[model samples]
Target: MEILKGIVLLLLVLVGFTMFSLKMPKGMKAMGALAGAATASFLVEAFHFYVGGDLFGITILRDLGAASGGMGGVAAATLVALALGSSPVYAVLIGCAVSGFGILPGFFAGYVLGFILPKMEEKIPDGIDLIAVIVIAAPLARLVAIGADPLVNATLINIGKIITQATAQSPTIMAIILGGVITVVATAPLSSMALTAMLGLTGLPMAIGALSVMGSSFMNAVFFHKIFKDKSTTIAVAVEPLTQADLISANPIPVYCTNFVGGAIAGLIVTHFGLINNAAGTATPIAGLMVMYGFNSPLKVTIAAALCAVAGLTIGFIGSLVFKNFKIKSVAEVRGTV
Candidate 1:
């Protein structure tokens, strides 16, 4: 029951974000900024703090990681505000105001400021507008962040705990679900990194997310090669699915279904080895694998990673064959190069 509830809640969040990205104004830009913030903060923390600091005793790197992690909200607010078309000055101001908040709260604050600041700038004279922002916008941004913090903890954090507990109780089932879902998200605009960070996933669930996405690099590479037969497109997808997001989004069924299969297979392999990742938001390909070494044996992580690669390759090939006849939009078609 707990697992079911977690899955439902997770689905709702993903779907809601998807709808926002598709329907809301500047939503896709905001989400892209969020992904960048996650990479800047969470990925840095995973590599430096967990892998470098915990594993190799690098004090400077550890301190750097700690600082980066704590500044997630600031990064999110600034980047998101800029993405949403705020001036750089206003964006940084909003970010500073939301310094102590979580990423989601900062995102909310930035989003609100993005719209309001532009209107304020239009109505008020230049210097007076700056004063207005200092007195009103900055405080308002912090308040928005403060208001959002508790809700984020209540909903997203609790859902993460429920999902992690479900993994403890039924590793196999949770592995398949989380593996498939998170991998699919990697290819989507919502971004697996942002989702995992927001949910605060760690432990076996985090491991499943990390390695499964690592496996997907191979899967998407092979799948895109088979489908598009374009060297650039294939390479882009392998490096980062978001680079080819429009192409992937245009051909969702084959890409998403194939990723689900590959991710599920990788998840099973990870669960079999009882791998764990204590890093909360390292659900990325390279950093994901790197962080595993902090929590598990190096040899064991390497072995599991190799198996996942094989699984991804095998599924990618088989899926390519299965979907050979499916109609897909060519890179040329999507990019209007033809």
Candidate 2:
């Protein structure tokens, strides 16, 4: 109940900020205004922490997601989709299932169309138009649902029981393995980055992870993708808009590619150097200064995580490059997917 209240109150503040700030125009200055609004939201949340109250989502705002209603952005997206052409069931799936993570998958799926639209030539040729749209939507829908379903379901539904029972003891290896598995499983068809966040925090690793990335929803996806990588969305479509909004994607490719390298490093170093992060928030390249406070300490852990992050970034860059090389080109190419 308290968590619910905090989420609601915080959202009210966000709504006020958005209305006041939205009128400031649309370029960089508007961006600064948005940042200011986000900062205000950040302070309000911090104030909640000071009062010994839970923000219901301190990590989202405190890190970089702007605010933490957690369910609104995607709902807005679904509304837009409904207004566009989606059915009620689809809209509900998108709204309830998606969070900020929708950006990448949605963009990727849409990118297919982005590319496809140009070459389509005059009216989309009747019967093929609907077929084309459906084709584009399949990958988009799969990935979007996968990214949203788990996290949205975690504590809200009874499904987390499966994870809870498995990791009840909370061993370090279990945490790592589970983290890796959930992230991988989080791939389209049946996964959610949100569920991974809840599952990733168990007995031994709860504190360390929340401090490192798990705590902040912004950092969670950033770091997760740092490990895996995205596929469903091309960078051109997915990266531009949301990056403007300051949201990250939950695509597994980046997370897997990066985290494994970093985690492997952490795995080797965790026992020997006794790596520890006490603060509960996401630590990114910008958040590096928390060193004295013990984030990414042991140097090796930080280094490892960095290596992991770089690995994902590199892989994503390369995958994108390779695709572009093959002349796959933009969302217009086959409506954006195979």
Candidate 3:
């Protein structure tokens, strides 16, 4: 029952993000900005602070990670505002104002103020507009962040808790569910990194997310190579699916279905090995693999990773064979270059 609830909740969140990207004004750009913010903050913190500081005894790197990790709100606000066409000065100002807020809150604040700042500038006189922005926009951005904090906690955080609990109770089931879902999300605009970070996932669940995604790198590479037969497109998808989001989004069935199968197999391997990742939001490919060494034995981590990669490659090959006859959009077609 808990497993079902967790799956439902995660799906709803993913669906909500998809709807936002499809329907909201400038939503895809906003999500991209959010992913960038997660990379700047959570990824750095996870790799440097948790792995470098905690495991490797690198004090400077640890400190750098700590600083970056705590600045999620600032990063999200600044980036999102910039993505939404806010001026650099106003974006940074609004971002700095929401210093202590979480990423989602900062995102909301930046998104709202991104639109409002322009209107204010137009309505108010030029010289006075700066003052008006300082007085109104800054405080208002903070206020929006404050308002969003509770909702984020109630939804994303609670969902994380439920997943954690479900993992504790039924590791195998949760492994398949989380592994597949998170991998699919990695290919989507929602971004597995942002999702795991927002949910504050750690321990085994985080491990599943990180390694499963890392495994997906191989899966995507093989699948894209076979399907597209384009060296550049295959390399791009292997390196980072988001870079070729247009291509992937245009051909979702094969890509997403392959990712789910590969991710599920990787998750089972992770469960069998009892590997763990303490770093939250390290649901990336290279970095995710690197962070696993911090929490588990080096040899064990290496072995598990190798197995996951094999699983991913096998699935990718099979998926390609299965979908070989399916119609697919080329890079030129998807990008409108043709």
Candidate 4:
């Protein structure tokens, strides 16, 4: 029952949020805000790791980080809502009221309130907009959060458990499945880092996911070399494919078809060699490959990653052949049409 409920919530949050963003005007703007804010929210940990500052036994730092993460969600939602034509101050206030859920859920919640708030403001008399926002929007937002955030958390926890079980029961097959899924999620508007964090995915599963994501990046760079045109753009997209979400999402066939192949190959190598990642969110090529340096011999890690890249390259070659049949629209053209 619990697993079923979690799956249902996962589908709702994933599908519902995806459709809302794609269908709504300026929805991608909101998604951009969420991504930026989510990365920024990790500043506290980043600082502690690099700078090593202490306030009230470092617990203060954590509290500050939590606050920043929460506010980041609010700010992201506000930016999107305002872009959708909500009033400025009201948008901010309502954004604050509505977005206590984590980044993605907060985005969906904010999108809903963004449309509704304008209608609500219109119904009210003059001179009391502040009251309306504070009294109505604030609590209503909390009410939404109370119901929504728990569902999201529950769904994430269940997903994590499933991955854990898979790794234990059938390592190779699970590696391919999870690797491909995580790679797609990472490249998509969804948060792969956040998903891994929720799952606490580490060891072999983490290694597989990291390799798959990196391999997919290599495949993308190779398959779209003409569009990328330069080393810098290719590298950037490899590290983070969200940079080209518009193009990738617009023409998903080649990218996804190749990614599945690359991901499976990477997964196979990681499982066969017993490669593992002790850390989470270090799933990018360099970061993912480097994490294994200390655990295994540097030579071994490099070879494993290189093999994954080779596999990705193989698929990219196949994808290129497949893509020859299509018109192969320019990235700019896709962006313009969208």
Can you rank all candidates by TM-score, best first? 1, 3, 4, 2
The lDDT per prediction is 0.92, 0.34, 0.91, 0.65
Global Cα lDDT for candidate 3: 0.91
Off by over 4 Å in 3: none
lDDT of 1 by residue, 1-338 (tens): 87788778888889889998889889999999999999989899999998889999999989988989998999999999999888999999999999989899999998888889889989999899999999999999999999999999998999899999988988898899999999999999888999999999999999999999999999988888998899998988887889999998899999999999999999999999999998887889999999999999999999999999999989999999999999999999999999
Give lDDT tens digits, candidate 3, residues 1-338.
Answer: 99888888888888898898889999988888999999999989988987898889999999999999999999999999999988899899999999999889999998899889878877898799889989999999999999999999998999998988889889999999899999999998889998898888988999999999999999999999999898998998888888888888899999999999899989999999998887778999999998899899999999999998999899999999999999999878888887
Give one digit per residue, the lDDT tens place, for model 2 in 174-195: 3454334332322222122222
TM-score of each: 0.98, 0.31, 0.97, 0.70
User: What lDDT tens digits, residue by residue, belong to model 4 across residues 64-112?
Assistant: 6456645645765676567666789877775677655555455556666
Rank list by lDDT: 1, 3, 4, 2
Q: Show the colliding residue pairs in model 3.
A: none
Instruction: Give me the displacement of residue 103 in model 3, in angstroms.
Output: 0.7
Candidate 4 vs. truth: CA RMSD? 5.4
Candidate topping TM-score: 1
Quote model 4's TM-score.
0.70
Q: After superposition, how far is residue 282 of candidate 1 from its true place, in Å?
A: 1.1
What's each prediction's clash count? Answer: 0, 28, 0, 0
Candidate 4: list runs displaced more than 4 Å: 1-17, 23-32, 42-101, 120-127, 187-207, 226-236, 272-307, 332-338
